[model samples]
Target: MHQPTKPTNPIEKYFSVINLYHYYFFFILFLSKVPVFWHFLSLIFLSPPMDFYCNNTLLIAANESHKNFCPCEDPWWDKSLFTETVQTKFDLYCDKKWIVSFTQSVLYTGTLIGSIFFGILSDKYGRRFACTAAVALLAISGCSLSLMPNITSFIIMRCIEGISAGGYIVAGFVFVVEHCGPNNREIVSALYHVPFNLGHISLAGVSYLLRNCDHFQIAISIPVAVFVTIRCLTMESPKWLMDQGQTEKAAVVMEKISKFNRKPHGSFKEEIEEYTAKRSVRSGHMHFIEIFKHRRLLLNLCCMSAIYFVCGIGFYGVSQYIGQMSRDIHKNIAISGILLVPASISAIFLLKILCRRTLLMITTFLSGVFMITVVFIPAHLTLLRVIFACICDCFFFMAFITAFLFGVELFPTSVRSSALGFLSLMSRFGQIVAPPLNSLPEFVTGLTFGILAICGAALCYPLPETKNIDLPSSLEDTKTLNKKNTLGDLEKPMDGQSTDIDKPDTSKKT
Candidate 1:
């Protein structure tokens, strides 16, 4: 590989030259999180449509209360008539509410598949290409679901959107972290949720504005179109490029990034050369199975996966059912949306102050404690329940956001996406089981959430703290700190051999 010459400008020495454009890059990549916001919104829209189908049955029953045996009145209610229409096909086995839950589960199932397949594919290709392709699929499939003529078609479309969404989320997070410098990485990563919260607000607003099905579909489709347009101009990660041995191309992208920030073109060549020199000796071709070859890496992945799964179930179980919670308290969806702002803001600030491990453990434990009290709160004291739920919501949001950043930090660049993909796969499995669990008795839901929280707390104890630690550049680095209590010792080797347990001088590495 030909190395480009270093820039002569003294001003280019600092990495901050590219900081100005960081937010712009962040926003474009973070826009992908909108699908998560849409997933929640879709649940809101989806349930009602199913209700419209099944609610008719309830109305029919109410009208025929006095009759000895009430016959089906309308063709829509007739078993045979239902068999002919789109709604009738799924109406036979389940009520609309169950159908909604089933479809959402189907979406998660597609996500599980997509995360594994495209997560690996993103590594093989480039992050930008893989993510952009996922966005295109999202726009097409999401729009198609809105226009679906029948129940069968709607289910299929939801599955397609889910699969694409799975790929997009994994790729988006990897792309953002790869571009960020070490000090600012956690903050930038947490900002991923800000747009998602805005999207949730948009969903609530849209639902309130267009309560009817037709208008709701149009409202959701608009953002999908916007995402596709934004992704077209998005840049590939320079880190990923360097990993693939394309240092010159990485430098060109860095130069463009400097230009985009309205800063003078800095020494991209110098930075690339420096970064390449530090590249881990480990090759990029390491398979997924190798993630476990090192015990510490294996333990780290397990802990992260368990935390992710519990958080996924608890978070989605509570969040997806918020509409029901709102109705239970006689509040509107807009109020629910407004209430989410605090949690999102708290997440942004909390991530900055706390290390990834401590923050996640504390929040997860607290959220579970709060949830156990939810059912016991008196119905007459509506204010107490709402306040308690809001607190729980805050913890849930904080824990969820922390896990995402924590998971990214745990893996080396070699299998970063693949490790995340596997974690995502487990999370999807949690999502798959949550809906049915929600149908359990109130006591059961609280108990399950409590168990989830406790599990998350336990998992946090085993994870190596990554606060202020540079991301591991190779598999050897990953193993060096596998059982170490402090990250300080892993910076450099004391002897020529890999075994270096003593603290090294940090000033030397740079």
Candidate 2:
């Protein structure tokens, strides 16, 4: 699409150029999400908890004869799918199975911590530094998993990996969104997760081919390493730079983007200076806690955080349960990834016409309905259950995307990173609680997601709609969103006057 001519808004006039350069960089940033999926979901294939039997011949024979549990001293995990894994290597069957879920929880916890830490780092230093540090740490922590001598070390490394992943998500997303014009940010935000789905699809193939846990771990880390090495070529967000009063750096970056897009620079440097001059000077750096000081901001953050939490539970929990449903985990994951495409594609059009709050409510409520539907299906209908679960997942995915976009628009640029980080922390907490749900009965699991989805939908009602609105640049700008009935007030009839519509239609033959 071409940039609008003679755009009045300064942000629009400068960064609205959507051309090959913009597309190219967006794709590059999107590629960064690929490794995130690989590392995040690799555990399913790496240490699949398949059923196993005793390796002892006598115990096996006795169990076969008795048709009961074997009294074998040592258990031999099923290696038909994965040749080597934490489960097989550590004999994590029977009593030790709890460790597997605990490991995943640890990972989520790390991400929870990382969200706040990196949020502050991103806001304080810069998006470029946060992104670079996150990726670099991701490579180190991911590759280190293979060399870990024990499960404890492995879990520790997983936590670190989780931190980097969370940091990358917050920093990277804020960076990309800040670069786009207001008109384009919605589509950009909606489509950003497409690469993540691609990463899931590729993870299935990579894990299917590499079977061994260490090999798979190392394989995924390779891409992260490459990304880290080349990340120096990446640039900081000009909006962020300008917001921080670094106009010269913002000018240079804007110049580069303009040149690459083949658009005239058009005194963007002067515009930046003028914009900064008019902006109110901040008394101090903003904090996530400041959100609590504003009633509307706090309410929005709480409501959005609730939605994000439910999205987390549904997204991560459903995926885990489904990954175990079929014999072919690869096919299951690949199909899951494939399903994400239509949700994202549908969102592009749906988001344009629908209010952000409306879309979130509808999607979340539908997700709950589908999840509850799964509880009614008979146990014998595995295929039917899988189909319904996939549908629920798709709806939740849509809600998840909407939550991100809505949350970004709800807050101002100054505290955007921290606010998003806290929201993500809530999401990670939901994920942390999700792994344990897999151990519950199928109906219980389904019911949990259903209840949470309904609550999430209810929470959406309190949030302000953010469709087609410019990103708020400060707390004062965000407060203006509360002025919804300003036009309505002007249209109201005065005490002594009657509006044409309110008056009797004498011209018409009533």
Candidate 3:
């Protein structure tokens, strides 16, 4: 609410100030996630064997001394290409292939542990500390994958990467949103996906050119390693600093940001003044336990957990099976990642028009429809499946982005990052289950899709809509939330008429 400080120097009056801190903000924020991006890449670049046939040429050339007949039982994969995938390194093909799924589960188990661990760390030590540790850990374990001696080692390394990923990703998302004014909040929240989509697209192109998982691992790992010093460069969130009652430190952090962004030093003064002035109501400290105090918040947590889990499954499930959709694995993966750019941008506008609850429900349901349909398209129809699968990913991405921002809006900032960490823990739990569920489609065609669809419908209606009001800062700030239906809030905002920062909160009205 406060404007940046005006320049006292006479020469400064003639030149215009351009806010440049946003670029650096995104740079470090996004770069910190390089290793986490590998979560998707490993699956694609290290694709498991879905098809197998004897090397027909070997069979054709066999002399009379050997049985020349083609053997389907232990068929070698036809026309496979890739220097290394975790799957290939350990001979995890045919019958022993469940090992691939188990490795994925192991990675998520680390993520699960990391979510809880780093969450408490971020809350206790600060976002900067938690984020830096997560990134550094990610770089170390991720690059180590290239040197794995056996499947056991690979599994251990993957789990470590998962743990670190949980912290960095959660810390980064919360940090960016916490930096913004109300006008910038929604867009910044949605745009958080840009970095990941950029990573996803780059992953496709780089993997295409690199042609080996070992190189790919090292390629993505080194940047985070290189940028490890960013922790020193960045400051703790001023909002968090304020909540902790360190007003002077929070003000200093805000001033540094204002100088970089070229905003008047007064730019952050209003928020700081308001927080200090209204300390009792706005700066109430929240721990993980407070997250479950209200019935509405608790239900939201549960529904959102299920919804996020389904999206996680859809995300990894569709990605792993993209090869099944088309002959060109590279082409499909490229398209899938590329689609995220427009999908993310589109969500920004849709959130304004549709409200958060409807949009998530509709998009998720549509994604489910696409997934179920993908299964029935007859495996041989490659082009059609490709078309349908890409469409599913688009909707899934839309829902995923919405649900992410939705979770942020539903909680007070006191516990926002920790709340997200808890959600991350649940989502990773879903990811843990995802690898095994990947095998489910093989046994029961279209089954996974149906389950996701049911989850979308059941989970979408119970969560409160946040589009019409200011973000909550305390549990007291969210007391009215439990009284409103998740869907009813769309018609009548829980915060009294879906007001903006400029409007007064009318929750006490009637």
* RMSD each, Å: 6.4, 7.3, 6.6
lDDT of each: 0.68, 0.78, 0.68
Model 2 Cα lDDT, one tens digit per residue, 8-110: 3355445555776678778778888898768778777877756566664555645544332445456655567788988877667666778887887788888
| 1-510 per-residue lDDT for model 3 (tens digits) | 422221121111111222477667766787656556766456657653444444445663344333322333443443346656665566566567778767767777887888778877776677788888888898899889889998888888988988888777787787776665443555777778877877777777777877566887888788768657767888887666766666677778867876776665664555565546743465446777866776867887888888888877776666666646457777766766787787889888887677678888889888888878877788788789877877787788788888888887788767777788888887776666665577764525356755675677568776766664445666655654532434334344222123222223333432
Error of 3 at 189 (Å): 2.2
Best by TM-score: 2
Give the least accurate 10-residue stretch of model 1, judged by summed lDDT.
Answer: 3-12
RMSD of 2: 7.3
Ten contiguous residues minimizing lDDT sum, candidate 2: 1-10
Q: Show where candidate 2 strays beyond 4 Å.
A: 1-9, 58-72, 281-284, 377-383, 483-510
Clashing pairs in 2: none
Native-referenced Cα lDDT, model 1: 0.68
As for TM-score, the candidate ahead, 2 or 3, is 2
TM-score of 3: 0.81
